[model samples]
Target: MSCQRGQYVTAAVVTAGAISGAYYAYRWYQENATKIPEQWTQVGTLKDIYAYPVKSCGPVIMNKAELSILGLKDGWLRDRFLMVVDEKNNFVTARAYPEMLLVHPSVKSSVLTLKHADMEPVHVNLAEVVTNQCAKTARVWGVEVPVFDCGHETSEWISRILDKSSNNFRLVYYASHGARTLRAGTSKIYRFTKNDTGALPDEVPFNLVNQASVDDLNTRLKETQVTPRNFRPNFVMKGGKAYDEDNWKFVKIGDNVFEIIKPCFRCILTTIDPETGVRNVNADPLETLKTYRQSTEPAARRSAGSSPRMGVQMSLRSAPGGLVKLDDPIYVA
Candidate 1:
């Protein structure tokens, strides 16, 4: 009976070890395995392109744009090129000033025109701003970024539109003072050179949002159905399943190839209505997304607890800098 009990104990220990080993193997696969499937079908076309010259301000819709290594090169390579800063040079956005949504921007040739309903139209010469290389460092998300002060005249114009006192708000252009590098926590899938840089964008140089994903969220909302304007995507893709962009590793739009960096983690800005410049009291879509869209991968998760993600941030890979036109055929690569 003693020998039989000893054998039973040995069997239990082996079984426990096997179970633990299997659990760890599964966890490893979940973190390291490729999310891409064996066959990724072409499920979308580039339906829209938006360039936000100023962060948190209105966007300029385009039919065709040059895709450079940095980002969409539209009008002096001005996607998020200009940002509104406070007296201390801290970045401002619609999150703090909801009225920023009402500011509309349009570009024609060398001119960038800004219009607000309550204020007169403000125009700035894009070439002139680019030529003025006077560098000033400002804070975006608390990181000190080098920028070109757009002169006191342009700063006063923006302050007037924002309804702030003089010297309280200023508009600064990203002057590329030094090599702008990616943050430390980026995934290891892509490479960035010393010359690679970004403007005042929150993270990646470009953001791609699936039309189906927004449609899916609208269906789940209680009262307000949001549009692509609310999400502020550089490329809006059509003909994909809801949230299909999450698995895409790379895609070619027209002549430019883009690599997906990671899924875009959303914030309270989504709950704000772009048209009305008002935020939803209940946080409709974000509350609903947290229930289902949170990432399971360890690298994708921002922290122990963070908001769920919806779209994917992309990086430009094409070297020659080609034109990505409206309705460009999008193919998974």
Candidate 2:
């Protein structure tokens, strides 16, 4: 009986040792085995509280903001909700045509307003504006899109505002705008005013950082005294540790969490501040991006899989235009 007991003890010890070794090895593999990135710890929180109607228009600031699971604000609409398309319904952005950078938009509760500082403000009634049911084909930002145009009134309004011959340009529905996390707006296409800031989105499909990247570019263009607003990020995350958002794949604002989809690409729009609608000499944010942040071969929508695309959208969220408390703990969930 004593000998049997000794054998049992030895066998149990060896088995336990093997199990322990295996566990340790498994942990090691999980830590360093795969190329897939692991969840990065949240060191800070960011609040996205506005939507830029035009691809590079002025911002429609929101008071309460939410984070989305996909990591983009709910306010982000894929195609610019408002645009000046040509005769064939072709679209435009600040990308190739830097002149378009001069146009700025301001959204109020009942109207969509445009500003050019030097030019008078043009307002479009939010109520009269119409939308389409199915997605149609259009092009903006070099990306061919299945875009739907807004109302005929919107086209007329734009024609007069631009003072062009007026062929067949109109507004497009921003798909992301309808993605609301609250019960505020009647539909996804409702107009926003300073008062409606409370209805923020989950996470806009795109995430923008004010200070770091843009500032970095500004430094490169020392002579160009451009404001970060020229870049028109959905929200500006400042006063936190530098680059706090670099690894932030997800963050929560109230009940909203955001998942970053793709990196926002820099365009000629960066050369102009949406606020002043003036040309900026900043280091052409696009020029710097070309060095890095290049796109993949099997690019998504408009990707030639060339030039760099940096801004990434998070999911949208609901908002009362609430304040995001500083140092708000962000979970990786």
Candidate 3:
């Protein structure tokens, strides 16, 4: 009888231990399931906010800008909503005409103004452009996007500034009502959100650069030092380790949250001086970055080739209309 009792006691203890272990496991899961695996870490501060009214032209520096699926905006100004295109409706950038970078664009009330060193400031009535311009398509990065012709005067102004010999260039406005599709090859290469439709930009809507990264690169540069402006990022951040953004997947600024899509690959565009619109003779930054910053991932390497990674391309994860302001604390996860 004692032997049987001992067997029963052993079985009961075993059952009890199993029950305790299971209970603890369940409790642990319950606690952890509701918690985020990665906590947000304070990384940096947004030093400057820029909205490029015209692609590859100049930035309209803002104290604060409203986040949109299309990108950053403030009242009458929007980011990359306007572009200069060739006679063939192909997008023209500072890449072809480095002088385009010197063109400063600004908007106030209903008026869009373009100021260049060589020409008189030309003003376009935004209200009129919206109402009177006809819908058309323009090719950018091999994708055709719906746009509106900003009429003859603006076209002549742009042509005169960009190419005085031929009146072939035209100014076009993004027709927000129409959809801009991404190229299939590009979509396959990068994990892009549904809203990342190429929208006048080369790829994603938002680009962010670490100022410390630029400062770091300057140390390596022999003669030509580049700035965040040369990268043409919408957001510039400081107070972080150089190239800290490479590890970031998501970032929070104020009430806005943005998903980092991929590292922005550096191109010859980075070799151009933002202030002077002149391409570096030695290609200091792009060439230097190529030596150290090439992607190791197979897919990224296939897509980016030897292009060096610099700023990060992003898409807004939070609801549109959140304001991202200068001096805002940036948190990354």
Candidate 4:
């Protein structure tokens, strides 16, 4: 009877160990499974390239851009290389002042010209001030980044256009910094490699959107039409299904390659009109987007209240540069 009891106890222990091992193996699979795309397909053609020299301001449409991990090199400089901040060095964006959308920027011969409806155009020579020795720290997404102040003349000029009581808003340019460490609060999914670098962008160096996604959103709307400008994507592509960008792991445009890092989370800024800077009051697209496009991924969702994704953020995989042109075939790799 004692020998028989020992055999029974030994069998039970083996069974319990087998069950525990199986459970942990399944858990490990679930955690790492999302890293690669389940399917890859030829999606579209690169339709446009838009660069915003000043963050949250108008875009300068382009026919081509030199793709780089640092940012889109358009000869003049990189996108979001310059920014507008308040007196306290807090980043000022279209979310706070819808009028910011009215400020249009164009670059030619290394000169950045700012044009608005109600004010005279202001021009800043990029080559002249890009190397200014003085630097001050500014905040973007709670990150204290050092930037070169464009001087009081530029500040006064921007203030006049916005009709501010004081010249509190200043235009500052990024001087150079080594590889920026992603903040602790940032999602691990968007974490950068040791070689990754960044400028003054909200997150990634490039934002790409699909024209089909915009068309799909327009079909659901009965009130107004929204353009690619409202979303402020650096690269706009066409020919793919709406939201096809979400499934892309590796993509090639022209001769350059990029890694689709994350889906962009829509915010209240999308509700503001890109032309007039007036926000939609009756049927905001964000409100409608929340109905169908809400993401299950915590990192993909901007906040508990925001809607689904409209675009994707990407980083260059092929570097030091290659020219990506309009109508270039985009392939999933």
Candidate 1 C-alpha lDDT tens digits along 1-333: 121111101334445534643454354334333333334357789999998888999888888887644467664546887889998999999988888888887767767787888778878765565443456789877767777677776677778766666657888777652225555644463444333346678877788889999999888888777887778999999998998777778877865666676677788888888887889988867788888888887755645256788887776655524788889888775
- Predicted candidate 2 versus true structure: per-residue lDDT over 46-123, tens digit per residue: 544456566544565555443322122223221235555677766655554454556666655535677664556666
| Best-to-worst TM-score order | 3, 4, 1, 2
Global fold similarity of model 4 (TM-score): 0.83
Which is the better candidate, 1 or 2, if ranked by lDDT? 1
For each candidate, the alpha-carbon lDDT, in order, equals: 0.72, 0.46, 0.80, 0.74
Model 2 RMSD, rounded to 1 decimal = 19.6
Top lDDT model:
3
| lDDT, candidate 4, 1-333, per-residue tens | 121110101334445434543453344334323343334466899998988889888888888887644578676656888888888998889898888888988888768888888778888876556443366788888778777777777799887766564597899887553334565566666645533435777777888889999999999988988988888998888998998777777777876677777777888999999989899995478887888888887655544346668898777665445798899988875
RMSD, candidate 1, Å: 18.5
The alpha-carbon lDDT assigned to residue 316 of candidate 2 equals: 31
True-structure RMSD, every candidate: 18.5, 19.6, 18.6, 17.4
In terms of TM-score, the best-performing candidate is 3
1 or 4, greater by lDDT: 4
Give candidate 2's error at residue 117 in angstroms.
3.9
TM-score of 1: 0.81
Q: TM-score of model 3 relative to the true fold?
A: 0.87
Q: Which clashing pairs does model 3 show?
A: none
TM-score of 2: 0.57
Q: How close is every model to the real structure, measured as TM-score? A: 0.81, 0.57, 0.87, 0.83
Whole-model lDDT for model 1 versus the true structure?
Answer: 0.72
* Candidate 3 residue lDDT tens string, 1-333: 111111101323446534643454344334323222257899899999999999999999999998766788786688998999998999989988998999999998768999998889999977566555566778988888878778788889888888794469988888752226767677366667445653588888899999999999999999877889989999999899999998988888876788778899988988998999878999869999998999999988988899999999987766656798889999998
